[model samples]
Target: MPVPGGSGREFNYPDVGAGRDDVSPAGYRSLEMVRELGTGDQIFDAASRRLFGWQMHRAAGIRLARSTPPPAPGVDVRLEWGVGPIRASAWCRVVDVVDEPDRRGFAYGTLAGHPESGEETFLVERDTDARVTARITAFSRPARWYTRLAGPLGRLVQRRITQRYLDGIADDQW
Candidate 1:
C-alpha cells in the first residue's frame, strides 16, 4: 500500500539508507547502540529471526500494527505506540537487507506520518569466536510537532526501546 502523504517511491528523509553507512547526514541526530547478546551461533540465529520477524519490536513494547512478514526491500510497516485510547502511529518502508554468512539485518526509512524523518537499522552479527552482538544504528530528526516538543525525552524513549530490543533477543525464551 502507498504511504499516506508520501510519494510511495521516496522516503521522507533525504539520506535514505544512511543508517547502513559509517556517517549519518548532517543536521540529524545520529545514534549507534551495541550490545553483546551472548555467544554461539544459536543466539545469533535467534536474534536475527526476532529482528526480521517483527518480534523485536513487539519485545520493545511497540505494537506492529501492520507489516510484511520477513522484511524485504520496499516492504512497508506501520508501528503504533501509546496506551489505551491514545495512540501514535508511524510508517516506514524497508530500504535494505543484509543477509551474509556472519551478519543479518535490515534498514528502514521513515514514511509520511512518522514522527521522525530518518532511517533505522537492526543487525545481528557473529564473530569467529562465537560471540554474538546486536546493533542498532539510526539517524533522525523530529518530523512532527509532538516529537520536537518532547526533545530529550524522545531520545530517552528511543534508547529504552533499543535496550528492550537487545534484551528481548538475549532472552532465549522466545
Candidate 2:
C-alpha cells in the first residue's frame, strides 16, 4: 500500500503523476489508447486472462523477478526491464482493479525508490454493441533527472511501448 506524502518504502496512491495534480508542467501527463479486439465477453476475457497471467509483461519484455500472476489490489511485484547493458528495475504494487460490467482490468504504481514516477491502467471492455476494446491509460513523469532530461525521446519510447501493449492484447479469437 502507498503511504501519505510518499515516504520510505511507500508509493503514492492514484500515483503521484496520475493526473491528480495539474499545477506543474512537469507534474503529470496522460495518454489513452483503445483498440478493437475480437468481440463480446470472450475478447475481454482473453485480455483479462492475459493481463492476470503476466502475459502483458511478457509482451512488453518485462521480467517479473517475483512472479505473481492474476494481479489483485495490493500485490507487490518486482520488475526488471531491458537486457544486458541497458537495464532498469523497480518495485511496484497493484493499486486498483476494474471489474464492472463494462470493463475489467487493473493498475499498478511504483514504490518509494523507483526510477520513474507514475501509474498506468489497462482495461478491456465490451460495449453495448458487442464490440470489445482494450484500452490503456497512463499518467507519468520521470523520477530521475536524466530521464526527465530525455523528454521527447522518452515520449517516443513510451509511444512505442503503448502500441506494443495494444498489439499484445489484440486477439483474433475470443
Candidate 3:
C-alpha cells in the first residue's frame, strides 16, 4: 500500500512475523509531518532555535517495507542521511493486528528501539478519502552526563536534532 499522505506511494510488508520485519517507519501511512520547534532547545519562556513542524492536513498511506521479507526475530533497521545513520535491531513482537472498514489496517510493535525499546505502533486509520493516519510517540530520559553538560541549552540541542531529522524527511522524496 502506498502511504496516502504525500502521493500514496505503494508499500507492502510480507511475512512480517516470520522473523524480524524491516518495515519502514515512514510506511506506517498518514505520516503527517507536523512541526519542529525551539530556537536553541530552550525549555524556558523563549527558545533560541526555530524549526519545521506540521500544521494539519489529510493523511495517507506510505511505502515502508523492504522489497523482500526476512525471517522472524531478524529485523535490521537503519535511517541513513548526511549525518550518518541510526542503526537499530530488535526481535519484533506484533501487538494488535486489525483491518477495519475505514480503509486501514493497524499493527503495533513490542520491540521498538534497540536492545531496549518499549512498545509502540500505528493505529492505522484513514480519512474520508482513504488517506492513512497514525501517531508515533517517542520518549527518552535525559542522560545524566549530557544533561549536566547542557546546563541550559539541553532541550534546545535536542530540538535541533529533531529538527534535522524532520528536515531530512520533508526534503526526502521517500
Candidate 4:
C-alpha cells in the first residue's frame, strides 16, 4: 500500500537482498564513527540492540508511526517526521540484518511510495585497532515528483538528517 500522502503507487522490492551493492552503482552518502565500546562483541551487541530498538531513527527526529514487537528481516515499519499538523510518514521494510565476526548491522529499503527509492545500511564494526565503529550508508533518489523538483534542497535535507543520525549515535547512551 502507498503511504498516507504518497503517490499511491504499489511499492516494489526488485532488488531484494541486494545489500551494500544496491547503493554501489550510484553516488551515495556514508558516515562512520569509531569509539570505545569495550570489546567487539559488546559493541556489536549494543549497536545492534540500539538499531533494532529504533533509538537511531528517534535520535534523528523520526518517531515510530507504526512498529512490530521485535525487529527482523522483512518486517514492516513506519516512521513519522515533524510534529503536530506538519507531519509526514515514510514506510519501509527491514531488508536484511548483519551479524558477522567483525561487523553487525541492518538495512532498510524504502517502499515505492516513500520519498526516496533505495536502501540504507546501519552497520557496526570492529577495526584492527580494536575500536568499535558505527556506519550509515544510503543510496537514494527522489521518488516523488515534488521531491525531484526540490532537487538540491532535498539533498541538503538528507545531509542534515545524516548528521542528525550521526549525532544520535554519538549521543546514544547505549
lDDT of each: 0.83, 0.72, 0.29, 0.69
- Say which prediction, candidate 1 or candidate 2, comes out ahead on TM-score: 1
Worst ten in a row by lDDT for model 3: 50-59
What is the TM-score of each predicted model, taking all chains together?
Answer: 0.90, 0.82, 0.30, 0.78
> Per-residue lDDT for 1-174 in model 2, tens only?
554422236784444434323232346777778888876777777887887777777687778754465777777777778879798877777778778887788887777667667887788888899888888887777777777898888888877888887777773355
Best prediction by lDDT: 1
RMSD of each: 2.7, 4.0, 15.1, 4.4
Ranked candidates (TM-score, high to low): 1, 2, 4, 3
Model 1 CA lDDT for position 49: 82
In model 3, state the lDDT of residue 17: 32
Per-residue lDDT of candidate 1, residues 10-59 (tens digit): 46787877777758899999888899988887788888888888888887
Q: Write the per-residue lDDT of candidate 4 for residues 1-174, one digit (tens) a residue.
A: 454543354455455455566444334443333444455555567666776677778889998844353456766677789878899988887768877878777887787668877677777778777677677777777788988998889988887887676566545554
Report model 4's TM-score to 2 decimal places. Answer: 0.78
Clashing pairs in 1: none
lDDT of 3 by residue, 1-174 (tens): 222222232112322331113233332312222332222212111110100111110011111234323211222222212323543223333333334443222233333232222222323234454343332333222324545565447545434544443343223212
Consecutive 10-residue window with the lowest summed lDDT within model 4: 25-34
Q: Is candidate 3 or candidate 4 better by TM-score?
A: 4
In order of lDDT, best first, we have 1, 2, 4, 3
**Candidate 2 lDDT (Cα, 0 to 1):** 0.72
Q: Give candidate 3 misplaced runs (Cα > 4 Å).
A: 1-88, 110-115, 127-132, 137-174
